[model samples]
Every structure is written in C-alpha cells, then in structure tokens.
Target: MSTLYTETHIGSMQLKNRFIRSATWENMATEDGHMTEKLYAIYKELAQGEVGLIITGYANIVAEEKPNAGMMGMYDDSFIEEYKQLTELVHRNGAQIAMQLAYGGTKTTYNVGERVIFAPSEVCERGTKTLGKAMTIAEIDYIVQAFAKASLRAKQSGFDGVEIHGAHSYLINQFLSPYYNQRDDQYGGSLENRLRFLVEIYTETRKLVGDDYPILVKLTACDFFEGGLTFAETRVICKKLAAIGVDAIIISGNIHGKANDMIGESFEGHTIQPQGYFHQYGDVISREVNIPVITVGGLTDIDAIETIAANTNIQYFALSRPLLSEPDLVKRWQNGDRAQALCETCSKCRTKRGNFCIVNKQRKATIAGF
Candidate 1:
C-alpha cells in the first residue's frame, strides 16, 4: 500500500488516508439550514468512496447571516440530531468527518441590503463589491460565542472535528486581511491584533470541546492581493496557531476580486491550474509549524501527489472539484487505476438544486445515447 493510504493522526482524529475532501458548497440544505436527504446522499457517496477525511460544506454559525443559499446551519441545537445522523453515516463508511464553521462577511450578495454584514472594518469587498459594516466589540464577542457554541454542537452531534473557516475572505479571513481590516481597535490594525479574532474563537471553542478534540483551521496563507495578508506574515500566523494547540492547518489562499486560482481558459468556460497550485504555500507553512499541514487547491494527479508528499513536509492533500466529478477517485487510484481526475474544472458544478459535475452529466448522457 502507498503511504497515502496509511493511517495518520490529526490531533486525536485518525484518518484512513492522506486525501481530504476539502469543503465545497453542495448547496443542498433547507432554507432554514436543516439537512436534507440530498445532503445526506452527498456525504454517503464521498464517505463510501474511501476518502480519509471529509470537511463538509461550510456551515453557517450565525442563523441570519447565511451568505449563500442552501447552506447547512449550526446556529442552534436544531441541527444536532440531524448532524448526528450525518456523522454516524460517515463513520459507518470508514471515514472521519469534520464540520467547517463559517460566518460569511462581505463575500456575499445573498441578502445584501436586507441585513447587516459584519467585517473587521467598513470596507467595500473587492470580490463582491458589497460594503460591510464595521463589527462592534459586542458583535465580535457575539460571533466568538457563536463559533464556540457551534463547535460544541458539532461535538455533541458526533463530528470527529471542527474546522474554523478562516479562508476565502470570509468573516475570519476578513479580519486577517490587511486590505479588508483597517480598524485600530484591539481586534484589528497590527497582525497580532488581526489575529485576535481567530485566537479568541479557538480559545473559546477549546474551552468547550476541550484540549483533546481536534480543532483544525482552514487558513488563508496569503490574500494574494496588493496591501493584503502576506505569506511572510502568514508563516508567523501558522507558527502561532501551532503554538496555540490547533491540531492542524489547511493552507489555502485568497485572490482579491477573484474566486479561485484557475488559469488559462477551457472550452468548458473554466481552466485548471497546474496540479497542487497551493503546494508552494503549504510546503513553507508545513516546515514552519509542527502540527499536520494540509494543502488544498487544484490537486488532482496521483503521481504528483505522491511526489509532493515524499518531498515536502505537507502531511495531507485536499480535493474539491475532482471529487465532485469522481466521488470514487480515491478508491480508483488505490485500486491501481491511477489516471488523473476527469474533472475539467469547468466551474459548472453549482446549480439551483445542488452541485453536480457537468462533465459527469455529459459522460452519462453520452453513454445513454449508445
């Protein structure tokens, strides 16, 4: 068996393999953020496919602050019973699952102008062009408590871990981004101040979930924008997070005004970047931190994955679009069919009903024509 198939630990959570299904919005939840059968099937497929760890689509920690429609909610206890079923289902399939908690800041148009969108500073988001209200001290405390409560709910509902969504210019990431966070308060200004929000969230959540439970962070290694969070500063942040007892860090980056790092153009209206586009960022952070480091973004090739794993300190690899196109990709590779994933990075996965791979649909249609 390849090393990628071997067991490993992220904190106390044991993963069956090195491949993690990075959180991708399935957009299948009910309007009120309840789990639906469609959402259950999505997890069932991924867990049954033999991935090591599955990080769910980011769940809304604030009930009225869902920036995306059909998002899973953890704002209250109403989610506990249904999520228990979700966690149990994944466990039965021999996989561990983590629930990613997020509060979308200005990266939204979901309910723009209808409600307040909080941020570290009142800035116009480059990506969404939505202006966010500067979060008050009271509001900041409220969100910290919300994350803590949601993490407890995750533990009670049987999640193996909880990942703080601190990437993609979301609420937490906004606080980390210098371009977005222009406040002079204790929660903003210097890098240390900018980091206070996440630290508090982790501290509060740790108190509730205890020191033994895994608390992972999906961190923006760099903002990839002018006057934004830099990789040099991010290294410092990673070291601090490791020092603070975060079980693992998943390295990702955000490009202001852009959604992803895909380059070139494809016939399907989206292009794929070179495999492991974020590996450079993760490689450095892995060396900087003692805990496990996972890299997510444009990773699809098995040989490349193996080479990177062998050469770098990055402990894990995560995939999103590739798995959307081939849920059984990990199993396929392990079964000796190591062909790279078929996902073209078409960017057509999002739909009104849910996220479905357009390539898969076309392939099925072609087969039906025969």
Candidate 2:
C-alpha cells in the first residue's frame, strides 16, 4: 500500500494527505484582483476532491505591477472579506489552503508602457521583450513591507498558510539571477547580496504573521539557462531559508524561459520531459534542510509517487496540470484504482477562461453527441 494517503505536517498545519495542489495561473480573477466566483468554483472542486492542501495562484502584491491580467490581488485590506469566504469554503470541505503571493516584475507586459514596472536591474525581460525601471532602495523597502502586509492579510482572512513566489523568473527570482540582477549595489553583487531581497521579505513577513503561522517559499531549483540562477546557488538559498525559520520550501524552476518546457511533454511528440523533473533538486535540498520539502514538476503516476516517498525525505508531492484534468485524482487513487492520471500533459488545458481540461471536454462532448 502507498503511504501517500497518510497524514503529514508542515509546521503547525496538519494535512489530510501528502497531495498538494500546486499553484497555477488561473487567470480567473477580476481585473482589479478580487477573487471571482469562477476562482471560487475551481478551489471548491479541489477541496472537495480530497486534495490535502491547495496553494492558490500567485496573488499580485503591488497594485501598479500586476504582471498578468486576471490575477488575484492582496495589496490592501480590501481583499480580506472575499478571501475569508474562500478559506471558509476550503476548510468546510476538509482541506487546507494557502495563498501564494508574488510581484510579476519584468516577466510580463500587461501594463508595461503605461506605468512603471520594477526589476532588479534594467534588463530587458525575455518573455515580454520589455524593459523595467530599476528599483531604488526606497522602492525596494516599500515592496518588502507590501509582502509583510500581504501575509498579515492572508492570516487575517483565514488562510492556513502563505507561500512566497520566489521562483518562475518573477521579481524575487530576478534578484536571485545574475542574468537579471546586474546592479553593483548591496542588493546585487554576490550570491549573498542577491539573496538579500528574499531574506528581507521573509523577515518582515514573519514579523507580521508570527512564528506559529506557516510561511512557505516556492523557489526555482535552477534557472536552467546560461548565467541565470544556478542549482549551486539555489542550494545555499534553501539552506539559508531553513536557518531563518521558513516553515517549508517548494522546489520549482523554469527552463530556457519556457514554463511549459519545465513540465509538459513535447507536444510535437519528438522530445519528452521526464516526469518529476524537479525531484532531484527537491531530494538534494530536502536532505540538506531540516524543514518539510514539497516538489512540483509534472509529477504523476501513483507508483512513482509512492517510490519517491518511500526512498526520499521529500515529504510532499504537488501537482498542477494533472489536477486540472482530474480534480478528484486524489480520491481516485484513494479508492484503489491506482492507475496513472488521465492528463496527457499536452498543455491545452490553459485558456483565457481559466484552465479546464480540453481532453475531458472533448470526451464529454463526443459522448453527448455534440
């Protein structure tokens, strides 16, 4: 029997099982960053589907720098009530939920020309091909406080935890990347300097949320390209986070600036991404740190998950695309079917209306004679 169905703890939070619903960009929120009913429906399904933990899509921390359209916002107190409803809904269904907070920085062009966007340095963002204004020390201080206040809001709104989005080539990841952070100041020269921004954010966030609340960080194990954040530097960052009292760490990363390449199998059917691509990093970091470690990177297959759990110190496995295709995947496994997930990892689930399984949709349509 697999041990994945057993209970686990991340700090004080007791989860029902080892399955975590990794955060994905739903693009289902309102333009102003409020959680919409669509998002609520999505979370509700996952909660009821028996996911032990759910990390909501990255909520934009600053109002002026929402890097993507339809992102949830946590810039002020206004977000509390709606989120309270969300947390209560998840809790009612017997699952724990955490809010993932982020600042998109130069990774997007959502409002690039109209407003000022922050970056570690004035490097051109490869994804959007846009430039950002290098932030001053005062601006950096403002953002640190923004993260702290957002954490407070998350706690007050009844979330079980908060995960800082320190990966995905976002603002924090940019600071940690030498390719992006060319600044010679205190925030940028060596690995220690590059780590300063994330450390400060964690310090301020911890102060507000208190020591008991679970504060997790999702970090890029490597930037997977030349001159970017390397795995060697990532190890040091994970160790520092553990020493400084982070409750848990989730290991993730980007490959050549393509998010899909990190997880999805080649759609052209020529190249295939190995399952659990990030597991090696998680295994190394988990052994090196004393805290809980969660790994996310196209993880599927019950047997493989069971094997990983049996052999490694990695405490949790997170899934995104598979869960999109089968929200009740955990329940399905629990019931003893134990087959691999139905998701093909084709990356077609992503759409403007929020991610839904295109394969499932087509199957249902065909069955209904549509």
Candidate 3:
C-alpha cells in the first residue's frame, strides 16, 4: 500500500518520500576535494525541490583512488567541516542526504598526476592500456580501513548515512567481478573471498558508526558482460550483506565503459521506452534480500513509477538524469502534472566542466520564453 510520496525509513534515517537522487559524479569540487558554494547550491536546490533522499557525488576515500578532477574527497580530516556545512544546509531545507564513499581503482586517469593504480590482480585494463598493479595485503587492509574511516567522517559531518559505492566497476566492483578479480589470495578466487573486502568494510564501518546509524550500499546487480558479476552472484552477495545488517541496497549495474548496458542508450526509432531499465534485475535482487532495495537508471515516467510501486515490493525509486532535468520532478508529480521527464538521456551531464544538464537548461530557458 506504500506510494511514491509515502514516508519510509532506511534503517534509522527517515525519508519524506520514496524518490531518491542517485549518486552522480558532479565535477564541482576543488582539485584538493573541498566542497564549493556551487556544489552546496545544487544540493540546496534539490532539497528545496522536495526530493526524498539525496546521495552526494562519489567522494574518494583516498587521494590515489580519485577518478577525475573535482571529484569530492573524504580522504583527509580537513574536509569534515565543509561537509558538515553541506549537511546542515540540506537538512535545514528538509531533505536527507548521504555521502557515497568510493575508490576508482583502474577506472581512473593519470592526468591528475601519476599515481599507482590498485586492482585485485595486476592486469591491463581495457581501453586505458594501463597495467594495474595487484594490491598487496597491506594495501588491501589499508583500503578497507579507509572505507570505515570515511563512513565515520560522514557521520561526524551530520550526514544521515553513508553509501559504500560497490557498483559501476569501481574498486569494490572490480573485486566482486571474476573478470577483473583473478587473485588467488584471501581477497579473491572464491565468491566469498571476493566479497571479503566489502564484508570487512561493512563490518568495520558498522563498528565505528554503531547499530543505529544507517549504512547503505550501492551495488551492481550485474556487470552485463561475459565473465563479469552476474545476477545470480549478486543475489548471494546481497544476502550476505543483508545478514551483516546492511541498512539498504541501492541496486545499480555496470560501469561507464559498458554505457549501452549500464545506462541504456537511445535508439533511432524510439523517443521513449520503458522506464526503470534495471528494474528486472532489481526485482530479482529485491526478492532475495530482506532490506529495502532502491532501483535506479532510466526511471523517467511518473506512470511507470506508480505502476512499479503498486505491483512490486521495491521500496524506493532513484532518478539521476531526470532529477538533473527537473530537480522538482517529485513535486511536479505530486502536484498532478504527471508528465514524463524531458531528459533525452544524452548524458551530456557527464562532461568535464561539471554535471550540468544542458538540455535541462535549454528547456528552462524555453519555458521562460527565451
């Protein structure tokens, strides 16, 4: 009987509605990873627009793990006050926010200056040709501790929770995928070994944050590639995470390299297709886990949202491009406009300048009679 606008709780964090703003890479922070006024304004706007929950852009857990310029950082203690200010602003505007802690692994570029890239095993990553060195046992232990410390910082900063980014073929996802994780050590080989990294991370984080503080995870339901993490494997992973008291699971998939399968591309004959491109995988995973499952990717239509809420036990709907196009999308739907989002999903927001949606800007200008 729950609806999109109904209030819900992900562990102890109570949200006003079921709509969540998925974690996106907003290239808006300083090179050293300080929060900026422009970044603060984006979350304030989303808060004022009435989105239920907002997960911030990926915040690197360590300096060497950063994926791009302007990616936010939690690697240092200095960044805590800035994030506290951000959380205060968003909370004052009546929205809940979570910081997504991540490590880029081999998916990063060296333009940020040369740093050794760490991976499950030393392997040549596709497209980049850069050979990632296998992470030593000490390095692996360090990364795990880093995740726990970052989660502690998120709590100290007054964020409602922290999301461990284990999706999109990042360092955590790389560990989960057999295609990338070929190590025979305790951190690889068997599925349990591969998942040990995440399990240790969650365990350590929970120990620091305690039982009441929410600790959610953004996980890939599938890598959608041959020899990659599959839906079946994902189910087992989800169950284990649930058993360890993961507050919720935000179901997502793949990395940017597999854009077609990861984000779903527009075809020649279709201007509009089904909403919630990853719902099928999410549905399967949702049934496997007892925790709330939030599904993201290609969820643009209001009708589709209502139908999914009515038919499935899925607890939350997360929108990325749609919120970029209309930050007040949930408000508009509640007001009964019920129109599908205008985002073409061209993903121009993924540009180097920042995560600004040019199509949304143009639409706004048009509405203003420009």
lDDT of 3: 0.83
Q: Which is better, 1 or 3, measured by lDDT? A: 1
Q: Write the per-residue lDDT of candidate 2 for residues 271-330, one digit (tens) a residue.
A: 223666677778889999999999887677988888888888899999998988888889
lDDT by residue (243-360, candidate 1, tens digit) is 9999999987674323344444221222323777667778878988899999888777999999889988989999998988888899999999989889876677777767778767
All candidates' TM-scores?
A: 0.94, 0.93, 0.93
Window of ten residues with lowest summed lDDT in model 3:
264-273
Candidate 1 stretches greater than 4 Å from native: 256-273, 362-370
Name the weakest run of 10 consecutive residues (lDDT summed) in model 1. 361-370
lDDT against the true structure, each candidate: 0.86, 0.87, 0.83
Q: What tens digits encode model 3's per-residue C-alpha lDDT throughout 1-370?
A: 4377888899999999999999988888998889887788889888987999999999999876677889899997898899999999999999999999998887766563477778888765654655677999999899999999999999999999999999877889989999899999898889999999999999999999999999999898777667888778888999999998999998875645244443444322111125776676777678888899998877888888888877777889999888878888788888888888888777876776777677765434212111
* Residue 132, candidate 1: alpha-carbon lDDT: 88
lDDT of 2 at 258: 52
* Total backbone clashes of candidate 1, pairs 3 or more residues apart or in separate chains: 0
Q: What RMSD does model 1 have?
A: 4.3
Residue 29 in model 2: lDDT: 84
